[model samples]
Target: MLMRKTAALLLLSLPLALARPMSTLAQAPVQYNVAFPNAVHHEARVTATFRELPAGPLQVRMARSSPGRYALHEFAKNVYDVAATDSRGRALTITRPDPSGWAVTGHDGTVTFTYTLFGDRTDGTYAGIDARHAHLNIPATLAYAEGLEQRPAQVQFAGLPAAWTVATQLQPDAAGTTYSAPNLQYLMDSPTSLGEQQVRTWQEGGRTIELKVLHEGTPAELDAYAAQTQKIVREAAAVFGGMPAFDFGRYTFVANYLPQTSSDGMEHRNSTSLTSRRPLRGPGAIDNLGTVAHEFFHAWNVERLRPQDLEPFNFSQANISSNLWFAEGFTQYYGELVLRRAGIYPTDTEYCQEALTGLVNAMMLSPGAARFSPVQMSQQAPFVDAAAAIDPNNRTNTYLSYYYIGAANALALDLELRARFKTDLDTYMRALWQQFGSQQQNYAPARPYTTPDLQRVLGEVARDTAFAGQFFRQHIYGHQQPDYPALLAPAGLLVRPARPNKASLATRLSFNAADSTATLGTTTSGSPLYVAGLDREDVVLRFDGQRLVGSKAFEELLSTHRPGDVVQLEVRTRTGLQTVPVTLTEEPALEVVTYEAAGRPISKAQKKFRAAWLSSKVR
Candidate 1:
């Protein structure tokens, strides 16, 4: 309440004229088509069907080339035959919108520009199956131009097979998918995906919410997906004084898990695309929900209330600012908040402990900790780089996407801030809302959040609360890791001797399940049995046709050699299975400074069982 009052006070101080542009969605409508009949050599036809003609070079731009990444990507390089047309389908004299789009003069009708995008569909774009099964993000791969972007008048799709479905955060259509927003800004606010969609919806609090996943996973595996998503979105909205985004809006979750893709997430405005070649069920399946929640939370923070550098985005240049920690990082923190809020996490202590353990492990295992400040330097990361804006717009290398790193900080910092106030953190968001929510509609208002910004916001909730400002300087602004043990202690998560999360073949051989049994899983370089010439699933047998009993026996034989040495093993054949002698290769190991020291050595009684149980490198 106080934050709201403070915001109102701040608004009253501002000139009345500047506030007008924030609330107005005053822009003409647009319609685009991301058509890819073939996953290979796909093209997106962004037709800005303007309802009215306006002055200026009628430019259209894309925000960096991809979503979940903040960089001005000149998607024009991906565009070809940048021509303009009138209602009769005749070419209208069009010029370049700084090279990314076609700028036309005169009357506004259906002006279309076709841009060919070779979206690395197969081996290159390893997130989804093919172009036909891909999700749209950043508007570059499908549609281009966001800077002078108009609301899509009628984004029509063509050259697509009937089996394909287009899923969007728009009004549903019986004949086809149609989304009608109040204005162009709202249209730009939502994203769409055209592919084979598996939808799941549920009714909660007297309203219907939908979850449309675009990928190649089994529908049965995603049975409980709607429920998991409901918990995440509902709890997240509850944090910021109830949900601010439209209750009826859609948030698409994209999945692209080729044989091998990075295990991470990229968040967008209305939807988020995840990397998943696996099922969205069982314990591991919940990974999709984590990302879904992460992206869903952004609807309030980044989509509406945002950073200044990000607002009124510039396509010709890049934004060299650092504020993603607030937008992306905080949303990430809320991702798990939804989990805990849903009772998926038993207690605050457990949540804190789990997050701390992951952090501590990353700290211990990372060798580039000195060179990288994930939270502070993420603006320069690959995900935020201006490849789309810069010439040689190639992102084959620079692989640093900072949302996860920054989000972790947001989670830790918000928790710390809340602890200092001895109150729920939602109060802070309410304060942000009261101060800027409605009036600060455009993204630019949240540019550089300076000392005064923190002071005023924090002051509103906690009288004389200067801890937030201090925390920002000491831990957030530089290459300094947050004081995790100290910040989370008040939340009651005691860090136990971290258990190494590795698996061993020796342990597999020794399990009580049975003898002469084998586990079917992927092979690894650091496995002891693999060092013993164990190729993935080469069943181990005794010498001279003798059978090895268990994983325990397997580990006892493995502790004998250092990594990089070769060992021989007798095994089975296709007639059954056979022994294949292979050399052990040493794998990169992160120094153990960050991960908690292994507790005192295992007891003598437990030593036999423990040694062959856990392998050091599996993930």
Candidate 2:
């Protein structure tokens, strides 16, 4: 009787499985065909077709947010002339439900959506199209059905010039003009550059690294740039023990250095989009390379060493993460350090002044650092990361960028680990990579980490739970800064006042050309300017009974005073004119310099430490 019951159940399941069939149950791939009919006018006509839809109204929409960006961008604003049709070429009824999406009915289980996208800006977040080239940032270019995110996608470029080619991380099909993505997340993250480009490729650690540059520079310049980029790539990989296994066994650098390109760098799973108006010569070259180093590091840090909060990135709203301090901040620290390690910054003084000094000063001087922890600052990214608003904000006093604060934290943590644990940040980073990033399930990280997980990993790396807990409690969750001077001592680096004898109000002032009076910009909290009740737009009419004539006069007055000196200031406030007492204080600006530059003898041990800290790890 039991055998008969089991046989009956098996016979029932077989018919259902055969009726549906595995192929019929699977969703068909979303298809996209893009044509640049009005390239000179910065317009690209795009068509996206969705098939095998469920029996309901098809909801199609443009993405309001993009990967690697924390803010919400209204991508639909640039899309217009939308029309939809069913599989039989019959026009479908489309209804507007919101600013970003359309609801279509009467589709025969398929809908073809078409639109004209006008894009004029060339950057990592937006699309740019012109006669010279078409730069497509996917979220800004494509629209998708709401329920079809899990379906694969295929995109093809049409009507390209004879000299033009495509460069993207999207896997190419047998047809050279078409590419494929596993899902909507991968499709949205892929940025494509189509135009005349110079291509260079090399093999590193048995994986291919390619650079495709769209610029007006000579081939020799591109050759030099590619060489420098290779060095940066190797140095970054050395920190992680090796490169992440790219999904397609390759990685790409899509660089646009044309005069019309905006300066931006965005990182993806297997590629980065680098755009700049700066040429690959003179000072601009180094600045461009700095961006390259920064974005390349993200392949390991943010793209894969995943923050749990940012995993499964959303498209309709801002994606907030509490770990940007580790994701972007640590990457920022490594971005500059990699250049130094790669010999781009050859001298200790140059590296200190150009990178380390600025990092420390930004963290130390900002009032935001005193008020918020690294995690708090990371949460504020949605409002500040390329976000646009007409209203003014008090960010100068209330917010410190996670990039600077995190980098400072990294520097201090690195020093502490070396001094106490017989280890360094590289070891900690490698540990994180192995635990969280190395095992790729598909397009995303298999083990995305949370804040507590970060602490646990640090504990493991340092072999001390107490130290890791304390470090996070004091710096990551609690608002406490590290002791910089103490941390730098072993490396023979000094953190000292940048301007020793100068007294300042520590507020920026803009002088009127018509008169000597100066209008103050935002006043730093706790500074003498703020203490005097002076704020933005308040004019300083008189200083110490002398008519404040110009910036020169104000500077001369400041030069005459010392810290602790008090002076009378007549200022025009928003309410009325008033007299106030302003006390002068030493400038809080700081600098990092070598001990030898400070006229001090360095011990051999310190020298060894500095060399080990700054030298390349590319063996």
Candidate 3:
């Protein structure tokens, strides 16, 4: 039997399963028996037999999207040695699938294909970071057919220890060896990693919580990460209702060491895929830890009690939405809030600063997000006509537009809700979680949500009842940027822009004829100059809301704003989508600095990223 290999790339924190780049076909249901032959050296072999084949010259196509990721990725390009055969063991013919898959056609009998998928445990398709470590993202790197995502599939494997704890969301039997999921969506969301995953289990306050880390790093460092992560997650779960709504024992963490990439994490119902550069140097390095809290929070918010768009996602097309702020952003807020409650953050100011930082960053990048209307962009992003999506600058605006903008607003709303209604912001998250996570109910199953359905949920926590739709129409789906200053002021948080340093600088910075400055490099220091004080995503209209000369003129204009002076500033936040005053401060000087933490900063795999991108040694 042969396991499959596929090709794919994750764009803008989005993970897509792509094997063949240009194919239009549906996948078919194929059962497979798979196994790992090496623990000392990780590898996977899959032998799949397709029984009950459809009659009409059928073609098998792999998905272009992964489980939680909403982008289209071709997964057939990397597959090799794909052959087909009949039930009588006779050979069948194969053909080019599309830009993304292969085709095997014959009589409606049992047919098979055997292939090897390089199983080095990394984040993306066939990601084998090293010899002993491998991550098998079968969905993105393997191909089936457009029609087969829902058929029942079973897998059996043997190569590692039977005692080694296994983590999967699929329905497991008494022996725990045989596993099954309701459909393909569950399978893709299930990323399988093999090795001695570090486990530290404990029962606190009558509930069991365990931290599992999969890695090849030093034992001491692994222990520290596991311990700290356990603390953060435990503290966070307590905030909702004393513990996770689901069992944490089966929860797995796949932390990949891939620097110069997404370096982010994807949250699932029971697990998460975190790609990062380990052994980080300082506070910046702790971003990954914070990411863990963010995704962990999603286990309840987005994964369990999800919105209409996500309940039954249309794998064939984009599930358009405007409420990503609630699902993603509010969780971002809770990540830090939980940490702060656990004393990990150590200071309320810092907690507020972290959330405020996200808010301010969005303001500075305004009008940038305005291009993609919530109704249009959310519906079209995964299937975006790439040719038409690229902006005039050859830069895709999506990197900062949708997710980031929505997340920043989410934090503000949670805080504002607490400040406004004087109650724990939204019970919608908890309510939804109770229905889906606890009672296992479905609000939206592969169906579009009506405007009233969304409003009904918001009314649970909304102080201003009639304004929910207006809020969505204006700040969310409209062209205006989110207003952060006012949102923060009500809660005693201030989002003041920082001025560049007196002597510190890295990337080459330049000003256009209009005073707008451009930070040129893979990572910029200031991030497009707040797009005219609009706040993280405020679209620059003029020097102070006026139509600029052009891109170059915009940069030149930024060169003229002085420190402490009330330069004209404006933005769009959730409170009312109105322009407000923001006092600009001198860009505080920042230098390469490191401080020792009680624990390890990153894993060995993640260290590789910092060596390539930062100024200090990771160790």
Per-prediction backbone clash count: 41, 1, 91
- Per-residue accuracy of model 2 over 1-619 as CA lDDT, tens digit each: 0011100000000101112335533767787767777777888888888888888899999999999999999899999999999999999999999999999999999999989999999999999988888788999998989877766666565556667778899876666546677778988999989888799999998889999999888999889989999999999999999988998899999989999999999999999999999999888999999999999999999999989999999999998999999999999999999999999998999999999999889888999998999999999999998999998789989999999999999999999998889999999999999999998775889899999999999999999999999999999998798999999999999999999978988887887767678898889999999988888889888788887777787788789899889989889999999999998889889999999999999999999989988999999
Full candidate order by TM-score, most accurate first:
2, 3, 1
Better of 2 and 3 by lDDT: 2
Worst 10 residues of 1 by lDDT: 4-13
Ranking by lDDT: 2, 3, 1
Best candidate, TM-score: 2
Residue-by-residue lDDT tens digits, candidate 1, 1-619: 0011100000001111222354334544444544443454344333344434444445555433343345555545655645666666776676654555556665354455444454443211222324445444434443444443433334444445555566655444455534444333434444555555677776544445556665455676566666667767677767675555442444555555443344556554455556555556566665667666777777677666666556554434555446665676567666776776665555544554544455544433333333355545556744444343333422212222354456556556555655566554567776776565534333234343533464467656766546656656554554456655555444333334332322223223323346664543333333555445444344555532435556566455445544555445566634576665545433332121112133333344333221221111111
Better of 1 and 2 by TM-score: 2
Q: How many residue pairs clash in model 1?
A: 41
TM-score of candidate 1 versus the correct structure, residues matched by position: 0.63
TM-score, per-candidate, Cα-based = 0.63, 0.94, 0.68
In order, the Cα lDDT scores of the candidates are: 0.49, 0.88, 0.51
Q: Candidate 3 lDDT, tens digit per residue, 216-277?
A: 45677766666667777766565555455343245656665434233657777667777666
Looking at candidate 3, the ten consecutive residues that score lowest on lDDT are 6-15
